[model samples]
Target: MISVPVSLVVVVPMCASLLIAVLGLTKYRCHWHISIVATFVSFIASLALLYNTLQIGRISYWLGGWEPPWGIEYVIDYYSGFVLVAITLVSLLTTVYAATYVKREVGESRDLSFAILNMLMVTGLHGIIVTGDLFNLYIFLEITSIAAYSLIGAGKKKGALVASFNYLILGTIGAIFVLIGVAYLYMITGTLNMADLRAILPVHYDSKVVFAAFAFITVGLAIKFALFPLHTWLLSAHSLAPAVVCSVLAASILKVTAYALIRVMFTVFEAGFTLEVIPATEILLVMSIIAIIVGGILTAAQTNLKRMLACSSLGQMGYIVLGVAIADQMAMTGSILHLLNHSLMKGGLFLIAGAIIHKVRIYDIADMKGVGRKMPLTMAAFTIIGLSMVGVPLTVGFVSKWHIAVGALKAGMWYIIPVIVASSLLTAFYFGRVIRNAYFASEGSDQGSSSKAHDHAHNQHGDRNSESRSEAPPGMVIPILIFAGLCIILGTAAFIPVSIAEKAAIMLLEGT
Candidate 1:
């Protein structure tokens, strides 16, 4: 197996990000081009790594030519390779879309710095996936978290700063928890390499230190991923960020956090310790089920379009956590499948929301009346993504639910089936309102105070909401369409993800 390019994926972006930051000082606006090329190069490297892993099995790269347990290591397996592909590819697409979107939203002066942050964000996320040491994981996790907080606050909205501050507080707390967990593990096992930890942890299977470490790591990851009850920071942070930034935050960071959660539980701790001995599966199951129902219920209560989509993410993420919590092979596969699925669908949804805001400055659901005709392509993309969100037939969302349901059945958790069905119905309730408002409503459909808001908008911005046939710029529309198309393609050719997920599931379950 090859390892040269594996290191390049992280190194290239890390170095380029520094260069981009330095370039940001000059008059030249070359940061965007450099950022896009760096991410695209990283994407190419991921493709090669995926190919190598698929052909020869998992590959490990040593840093400074040192062996594991003493030196840093980077491993590429089916799972990490799969996620790296998603992370890099989506980062590339967002970079392409962000050039114009950022120009229009955040203005031209901030574009260079934005591109630099974007590249660093991508670099940090890739580093999180490739690193194979517990301490290194925490380190990389911090890198991504800091970048996210800065990006979230980069918007012009007043609320953006508050939201970013909230995230900064909570995210730093989560990072500390992770650090403490890693230290506890190190104290007990005397090694930070994940493979070495897996080997050593079993001997201290009953140790309280090991158990405390697990608790710390899981809870920290839950908060970091914005899992329910801990999700207060996400609504404003994600909704207030610039469209491109929000899309990346919604799509990549938490998905990767979920991956890290799965890796720590199943890889570092071992399934025997996590599933059979400590019984974390059932605890996670109950929490996930709660998140599934409450997240959906809360999403339906939002008046703002972006807040609605942000809440829906809370519910959708529950599906992935549920799949992981179930501890059944099919459940694991379904969870992993949903991870990729949610990234595509939700990423597209947020991008569409951005497009809508850019074109019409409408943020409230009540303000979206008759928008379908005005921004047909943007709304069409939005509708396609929303349908997938509701798990409509022939969409990737449906496929995710089907597997999760079957996995629940396989695990004899018959009660969980109704949770899945009921969550879908609730999802339909909220998204259905958006569809009806967009397609079947009159110009006066805003009902009561929406007219007042519109008048205020008119006074402030001179008929920005006037009905028109314009759509988001082609740069923005193309990425939304690409993600929407993947919803159908991945759903129809379900074997591709199912195959990868099943392999990942088996290897994870059987590794020890």
Candidate 2:
């Protein structure tokens, strides 16, 4: 097994951010190059860490060579290690895709800032994954949130400024709640280390202070992850941000936030506290069901393609939360698997959306007639990914959904099965709209003709013939295709992620 510092994954990108900032002052225009290399290094380190964690049970690193409870700690078990891999892999691809897409959307003047903010955001996310100190986690969370706000606010889109402002207000409230929860826990336990908190909190599980802390933390994270009623800010932020930003936000940022919630519920506090002492599981179950239904209905109501995908993410978040509420090993495994699968699926979808917009300047679904012929390869990838989103069999989405369904049955919540079915139908209803419009809609129907579509394309790239292809640059298209391919490859080779997720679920349930 390889021996590497757990902090390596966080540090590399951080250093690169600093380097980019310095270079930006001197007119160096290779910020994307540095961002890609930093993310690649982080991805490699994450893989090594995952391999080591699987071979050895758990890994921990201490900052400043001090022991835990007295100094900061970074811990990686099955769960964090798996999450590290997912975040870094997607972040790496997003960086690659952004190299070309950012130029088209945000222009060259802001590329330096984009690269710097992107790296900083990545640094914060990696910090969140590895940190074992509650206060440190909160710190990392703020770093991530602030960087995200800047990235979104810097977008050239019409509503980008408004979207960023909404996200900032909501995101700050969530961060404050999390900070308060951390302070409350520290006041009681006198330790910021998560391991120590787990060891100490059980005796005070029935205390009102402990209950309040749990409530505060969970609600804050719910907002951060855009769960149901707290999700008002997600659609605008996701839909209006730059495509690369959308890809990272949908794929990595939200998943890690959900991971934090799971860690707090299952690791810091015992299962009994979450499931019985506080009725947390039951509450989550109700919220998740509502989110799944409402999110789907809203998704189908959207006219813009990016808005539709953003709405669908709300429903997808519901699936992950459902698995958590089930609180069974299989359910947890499904939740974790879906985290990885959804990252690949939604990330690719957003990239495709960006590609379409970049190539043809079409964002509204009604304007997408004959897009399939105009961008056949891109649309093909979209079709596969869209199908995966609908939980079609032999795709990664179906595997995770199947596990969640079985988990529901195993937990004797047979009613949840129908919720899953209903969500799937809703998913098909929405995604199928795009699929049909892209591939089967008559080119000369009332929507628009192939020639007219070319006229629309003319605005972007200047006078393309009806028969010409309008794929995004190779840098962007390659990553989108890679994400789509992984959806199928990982679906068929389900054992890879399942084995890791199964182990993580077991450890989480057993409180190891």
Candidate 3:
């Protein structure tokens, strides 16, 4: 009987998205205004939900007046509410960013396509966070995945198509695995509602079907999350896709998969057969360590800015998984906080990358040398982001790492301290390279001595006035500054995030 306005929170933006799609790409003049306003409204609604949760209690809404044990429901607690805020903020910022960048990256026709894709992407994200049914989660997952595949393919680069194709193949496989798991779960439990299933699952712990369902959910969710080995499609897809696409996918969707994985592991299966019967924690721990080491090392090796950042994402995911793997209250708390922090840092970094790409039309790390001096504001923003990635103090990244370190200590996994230290160093090393190139490295003879076949487009750089005018447009620059400003503001307003993350973390640990 909870009368929360959950439906309006998710539906309004989604309806607008669909409307934009129907209006067609060309004629829709105010797509930016529409998208930005929709997300902003959603963000405000989420904040209201957060306030209501603190003042009241959990919020649940039944669809069509159907009760929870039988019909679909929308549930929001501390955790879901916090994530809703993060998703909305990032989606809003990225939409603002895409307004100008999309036109520059692709044509105006494709700009509309980007807008439509973004709207659906946010809808899918909102759907995942709000749904109370297991099958509904799968449905939302598909919606998000399909939109993501289309966006990745929206890139003009040939590599974008190949990346999207591979992601399509792998994403389909992951979704199938999840669907199969959901089916097995339903077959055994005879219910699709998550709350009902959670309550009923523990009673059937000894059944083979339930165990199979556990395996399916764990493995399937891992694949969708791009945990280690299943991450092949992620690097290239993130590297080649339009910058706006990368920012959204990296900042939110992948994290959502991890969020789902944790929700299933902790909330649904924490008391089920899986935790008691298997060494799931140890397995997650080992894989996480491998991912951390491998992702960091590989990040150091990439020459392209996008690919390097993409590989770095794998490392950050590993850290989150590591926290879950450690399975201590503090570690889990750190993991959850890191999830939000990583989204901000990575999203900001990618946005700046987009700015660089828009202004210079280049992707190589070498080409970025001393260009920071030219694009001081953009590079300054990039520097803050880069420092955050390295977990520098007074940045949001540091806050997460500090919690993670404490968590590692609490778990008595002192060995992980070294891994954390080493990975931090590796992060510094690779990010440092980018910093050096951006600020100090010489412009060099490479200006006109380029061998890239794509340099033909810039052959007209002889006209200095036109080249200077090529800086990123206002829509692009404004969002970048906004995100960069957020990095500083959030970093300074440390208690706000700490309190929210702590509340969400406590919810996950103790289970509402």
The TM-score leader among the candidates is: 2
lDDT of 2 by residue, 486-510 (tens): 9999999999999999999998888
Query: TM-score: which is higher, 2 or 3?
Result: 2
Clashing pairs in 2: none
Worst 10 residues of 3 by lDDT: 459-468
lDDT of prediction 3: 0.81
Writing each residue's lDDT as its tens digit, candidate 1 over 1-512 gives 44555788888888988998877677665777888788889988998898898888888888888999899999888888888888887888888889779989988877777877888888888998888888888888888888888888888799999999999999999989988899999999899999999988899999999999999999999899988888999999988899888889888998988989999998898888889998788888988999999999999999899889888889888999999888888988889888889989888888888889999898888878768878888888778878888888888998888888999999999999999989999999898888766755556434523444554444324234545698888988998889988888988898888888788888888882
In candidate 3, what are the lDDT values of residues 197-285, reduced to their tens digit? 88888877778887778778778778877899889999999999988899998999888888888877766665324345677778889
TM-score of each: 0.95, 0.96, 0.93
- Model 2 segments more than 4 A misplaced: 448-465
Ranking by lDDT: 2, 1, 3
* Candidate 3 clashes between residue pairs 3 or more apart in a chain or in different chains: none
Winner by lDDT: 2
Give lDDT for model 2: 0.91
